[model samples]
Target: MELLHKFSFRLLPPVTFNFNHTRLASLYLSTRFPVSGPAFSDPGPLFTSRRPLSSSVVSKAGWFLGLGERKKTSLPEIVKAGDPVLHEPAKEVDPGEIGSERIQNIIADMVRVMRMAPGVGLAAPQIGIPLQIIVLEDTTEYISYAPKEEIKAQDRRPFDLLLF
Candidate 1:
């Protein structure tokens, strides 16, 4: 199977800001680059020859800013797009299992993994779990890394943690 990833490049017009009068504005210029991964099986091995969904520029920036530097986390490898688990319907979380240790641990792990991925959201199936659980957070920290115009265009803003 083939894995395709799309990246958008945004260009902004220059803005002059005075300390006394600060104003931020930008114009959007976007271009898409389609990155194709090497042919692989539907159910590939964990973290093998997979192209990351994020852009190389972002990755490099993160590295330069020390955002990429981190101790190894024991979280499960994020399942790739072709994984059957991702395509199938996830089982509903049992009400009785809501407060169970396993569920709590999964939620914790999900949050950790999502933050480490620096993504806004993640689903249980993305971690190879077949439960209907999702974790999401949009923090000011994450937004700060993005362009002001892009954030405004998307109406993006910090949001409290959400789990279901």
Candidate 2:
């Protein structure tokens, strides 16, 4: 029994085999030690010829590569379309009002809300306030690929409305 055990272990050496070697060895071993399990009872087919998948498979690959999903932009509630306040011209905000602690607190709050909404620009009118106050930030500035001359011309405009 010990000799038989040693021979069995020797026949199935534990060397790591490449894919082709593994397949060939499995084929050789099948003839040597034919399994009598339910899985191999009928032996349906030995091998099926494998060809590259059709162009339909390429479509699946292209779908993943293209990333065909549009990003949704979220705007602030106060500055939405059809708001009466948005139509009304903004009132003049005194520099003194801007310096006030209350204004500072409001600005901080607005900044927090803007960050949460991920907005590029926010106006006081959007927040139900008629004050002529606005803040803007753009996250796409770094990757924007506009021409330098055009960007400079846009910078010369009254407001910095160029989207980087």
**Which numbered prediction scores highest in lDDT against the true structure?**
1
For every model shown, what is its TM-score relative to the native structure? Answer: 0.54, 0.38
Candidate 2: C-alpha RMSD after superposition: 18.4
Total clashing residue pairs per candidate?
0, 2
**C-alpha lDDT of candidate 2 relative to the true structure:** 0.64
Best by TM-score: 1
Instruction: Report every candidate's CA lDDT.
Output: 0.81, 0.64
With candidate 1 superimposed using the best TM-score fit, by how many Å does residue 107's alpha carbon deviate from the native?
Answer: 0.6
Clash pairs for candidate 1: none
